[model samples]
Target: MNQVTGAPGTSRPGGRTARVREAVLRAAGDALVDKGIGGVDLAEVARRAEVGKTTVYRRWGTVPGLVADMLAEMAESSLPRARTGALDTDLAALAGLILKTLADARQGPLFRAIIAAAASDAQTAAALHRFYRVRIEEWAPCVNEAVARGDVPEGTDAAEVVRALSAPLYYRFLVSGDPLDAGVAERAAVAASAAARAGVYA
Candidate 1:
C-alpha cells in the first residue's frame, strides 16, 4: 500500500505522495489561472513542485492526462450537497455553494482557464464533461429527495434542477463580472423550485 498523507490512503510514495501531488496540482492550477491551457508545461510544473520532470511524466503521461487527474482530484475534494429536507432550502444552499465556489478568486480563474482549454482540446472537453457529470451526480440526491417529499412532481429531471441551481451563478461569473451575492442564490433557488413544480424539468 502507498503510505499516505492528508486524508489517509491517498498517497503513493510514503507520506509524501499526497503532498507532492497537491503541490503539483496547485502549481498546475496556478499556471492555468495565470496563463491558460496554452501555457501549462510539465517541466515548469515540476520545477514549481520541486519534483523531477520524469516523476510528473510517469504519473500523468501527458498534459491532458494531468488535466484529467487534476479535475478528478477536485471532484474527490468537492463538498457534498446539503440535505435540508426542503426543496427551497436545499436548492438555496446548493446555489449558494455554487456561487461561492465560482466566485473564489483562484478557483474561478482556474475553471475559466479549463473551460478555454475544453474549447480546443477534445481530451480536455471530455475531462470537463466528466467533471460536470460528477458534480451533477453529487447534487442529484437532493432533487430526488425533494421529489420523494412531494415538493416537486415525479419525473422531474434531477440533473436539470441541479443545473438550474448552478446556471445563473456560472452566467454571472462568465459574463456579468459581478459579485455572486446571496441574493442570486435565493432567487436562483426560487426560480428553479418554481420551474420544477411547473414540469419544466419533466
Candidate 2:
C-alpha cells in the first residue's frame, strides 16, 4: 500500500504517491490552460504526467473532482492579499497584484479557463466561488484599516469594498477586452474609498 502524505497535491517525503498526485494536478492545470475544461481528459492527463490511467482515475474519480482538487491547490498556493497601514495604498497594492496575475500569459489563461468552466458546470462553479471567497477574506483587512483611520464609516462592508477593487479588472478580463490599465487599480481604490465614505459600503 502507498502512503498518503504531503500538501494536497505536492510531493511529501518525496514519495511516489505524492509525486503522482502532484503530476495529475499540474497536468490538469496545464490542460485547462491549453484545451479548456471540455478538452481535459483523465487518460490524456495521465499520459502527460507520465502516470498510469488507473492512478489518475483511482485518485480523482472524475473530471469535476480533479478540477476541484486543482482549484483547492491553487487557492492554497496563492499569497495573502496586502494590508499596509493605509487603506488606499493597501488596496492599490492588492489590485496591482490581482492585475499582475490576471495579465500573466499562463496564469491568466488558466484563470480564464476556470471562469469559463464555472459558467457551465455547477461543481466547477462552486469551486471558483469558494476560491474568490477566500481571496475576499484575505483582503478585507484593508477596508478595516480605512475604518480605523475614519476614512470610511465604521462597520463598512469590507468584503463588498474589496470586491469592487477587482470587479473592473474582471470586467476587462472577461468582457471589455481592454487593457488592465495601470491607473485602473488606483481608480478602483478611489471609487471604493468614496463609496465607503458615503456609507454605501456599510
Candidate 3:
C-alpha cells in the first residue's frame, strides 16, 4: 500500500480538499507525460498546480506514494462496468472505452511513461497491478453474466476474459504499434468473446 492520505489538517472527501487533489494530480499527470516519471517531483507538481509545496509533501510522502495515490484516483474516476444484459455489447463497450483511453492524446503518453516506470519500480508496479485489478474486477461481472446466460461455458474465468479483451489493444499501444480504431476494438471483443464461448478460458 501507499502512504496514508495526508497529515493533520486534511479535509474530508470534498470541497477544497478534492479541488487541491485534482489540481495536484493534473499537474502530476502533466509532468509524467511531458518529461516521464524520472522528471516528476513534489515541488514541481506543487508549482504546476499552484498549490503549496508543503501540502503535496505532507499528503504524499514519496514519489511512489504519490504515484500510487494518482492511480487510486484514476480508478475511482473510471466509469463503471456495463450491465447491458448481453456479453457482446458489454465487451464491446469495454473495448471501445479502452481504445479511447489508449488512443487519447494525453492519456496515451501518460500511460506509456507510467508503464515504463513500473518496469523498474516495484512500488509503481504494484500500484499498476492494483489499478488493473480494480478495473478488471469492475468488468469481470459481465463474463459471469454470460456464463449464467449460457452465452459462454460454465466456470469460465471472468478476470481472464476481461484481461483477454484488452490484451491486443495493449499490445498495439505498447508493442506492435498497430493502428487502434473502432474496427480493431470490435475485432478484439469478437475474438475474446468467441474464445470464451469456445472454452478457451474455461
Candidate 4:
C-alpha cells in the first residue's frame, strides 16, 4: 500500500474500529507533541493507546504513516467556515477561529511540533500542506460572496484573501513570537478586508 490509510484496518471509523483508531490517533498525537517526530514509535503509540503492538504496526506501519493519518483526521474534524453574510463579519469570524485554535494550550504546542516535523519529513510536509489546503478551500467562499455583493473587486482572488487573513496570526504563532490576541486578530481581518476591497488581491 502507498500509505497506512490504504491499509486494511483503515475504513471510516464506526464502532470498535473507530474507538481503536481514535485511541491510537490520540496516542500518536500525544507522543508527537511530547517527543517530536523522532520519538514517535509504533510500539510506544500502542502502549500509550492500550492497544496491541500488532494493531499499531498493522494499521500505521510507520511513523510517517501514523502522522499522515492523524493529519487527515484533524482536517476531517476541523470546523467549517463562517456563514455570516457580510464579508467583514465573515473574515472576522474566520480570524477568530484561527486565533482560538492557535491560542489553545494543547493545540498550540501540537501544531508547532507538527510544523517543525513537517520541515524535515516529506510525507509529513505533504500532509501538512493538504491540511491547510482544506482550510483555505473552506473559507475561500467568503471572498467569493464578497465579490457578488460588490464589497471587494470582482476579480479579487478569494484563496489569497483568506490566506492573507490568517498569515499574520500564523506569523505570531510560528515566528516573531509576538503575542496573539483579539486585537491582533481584528487587525488582520480589517487589513485583509480593506486590501481586498482595494483590489490588492485581484
Candidate 5:
C-alpha cells in the first residue's frame, strides 16, 4: 500500500519542498485572480506551477483545501500593524492598508473571487474568517495602546474598533461599487477614532 504523506509541499517547511509549495500557491493565486474559484483545477494548477499532478493531489486533495492553504499563506505574509503612537494615526495607517489592498488591480479581483467562493464553500468561509481574525488581531494592539494612553474609553472593544475601521471600505469594495480612495480611507479612520473616543465600542 502507498504511504499517504502529509499535504504535498507542506510536510517540509523549507528547501526544495518549500519552493514547490510557494510555486504552487503562486500559480493558484494567479488562477484565482484570472478566473474565479470554479476555474481553479488541480491538474491545471499543477501544470502552471510545473509540478506533477500527483504531487498537487497528494498535497491539497481538493480545491477548497488548496484555497484554505492559500489563505493560511496569505495570513502568514500579511503586514504588521502600524505603531504610530496615536489612535488616529494608527487607525489611519490601518485604513490605508485596507484601501491599498482593496484598490489593487490584482488583489481586488482576487478578494472578490475569494469572497464569492466563501459564500458557497464552508471550508473556504472558515478560512476567510480565520484570515480576517489574524488581521484584526494584528491591529487590535493599536486600540489597546489607545486605551492605555486614555485616547479611548477603558472598556472600548479594540477588535470592534478595528472592524469598524474596515467595514465601510469593504462595503464600497464589495457592496455599493463606490470608489475606494484616500479620502474614503481617511474618513474611515477619522470616524472610527471618533466613535471609539465616544465609547461606541465599549
Candidate 6:
C-alpha cells in the first residue's frame, strides 16, 4: 500500500490527497474572488496551488468540474445549524451567520463571483443550487425542532422557513446592494419566525 503523506497547509484527514484538494480549492476561490469565472484557468490555479498543471487537469478536468468540487468542499466544511432550543433564537443565530458571511470582504466577493458565474454556466448553476440545498437541509432541523416543541404550526415546512430566513439577506447581498448589518439580520430572523408561527410555511 502506498503511504499518503500530509501536504503543507492542509489539516484535513486523507493526508496528501486532502491537502492537494484544499490547496487547489483555496487557489480557485482566491482566483474567483480576484477575477471571475472566466478568469480562472487550470494552469493558473495549479500555479497558485503549487501543484502540477497535469495533476490539476487530471483531477478536475475542467473549470466547471473544479468549481463543482469547490462547492462540494464548501458544503462539507460549512458550519452546522444553531441548536438554541427556540425558533426565534435559532433563526437569529442563522441570520447572524449569514450576515457575517455576506459582509465578509473575501467571502462576499467570492460568493458574488460564484453567483455571477452560475448565471452564465449551466453546470455552475446546478452546483450552486446543490450547495444551497445542502445548506438549507442542514438548517431545516431547527425549524423541525420548533414544530416538535409546538413553537410553530405542526405542518410548517421546515426547509421553506429556513429558506425564508435567508432570502432577505441574500437579496440584500446579491440584488439590492443594501448594507448588511446585525439589525437587518435580526429582522430577517424575526420575520421568518413570525411567518412560521402564523402558518405561512404550513
Candidate number with greatest lDDT: 4
Taking the tens digit of each residue's C-alpha lDDT, what string does model 5 give over 73-163?
7766668888889999999999999998888887788788899999988878877887788788889999999999998989899999999
Relative to the unseen true structure, what is the C-alpha lDDT of residue 42 in candidate 6, on a scale of 0 to 100? 90
Candidate 6 wrong stretches, greater than 4 Å: 1-13
* lDDT scores in order: 0.80, 0.79, 0.85, 0.87, 0.85, 0.85
Model 2 regions more than 4 Å off: 1-16
Per-residue lDDT of 45-143 in model 1, one digit per residue for the tens?
Answer: 899989999888888766777777778777777888787788888888888888777878888788888988999998878878877888888888888
- Tens-digit per-residue lDDT, 1-202, candidate 4: 1122442334566889889999998999899999999989889999999999998888778888888888777777778888889999999999999999899988888889999999999988877887788788889998999899898988899999999999999999999999999999999999999999999999
lDDT of 6 at 161: 94
**lDDT by residue for model 6 over 84-129, one digit each (tens)?**
8999999999999999888888788888999999999988888888
C-alpha RMSD in Å of predicted model 5 compared with the true structure: 4.9
For model 1, state the Cα shift of residue 88 in Å. 0.7
> Candidate 2, TM-score vs. the true structure?
0.88
Residue 128 of model 1 has an lDDT of: 80
Stretches > 4 Å off in candidate 4: 1-11
lDDT of 1: 0.80
Error of 1 at 201 (Å): 1.0
**In lDDT terms, how accurate is model 3?**
0.85
**Can you give the TM-score per candidate against the true fold?**
0.90, 0.88, 0.93, 0.94, 0.92, 0.92
The predicted structure with the larger lDDT, 1 or 6, is: 6
Candidate 3 lDDT by residue in tens digits, 25-90: 889889888887888998999999999999888887677777777777777778888889999999
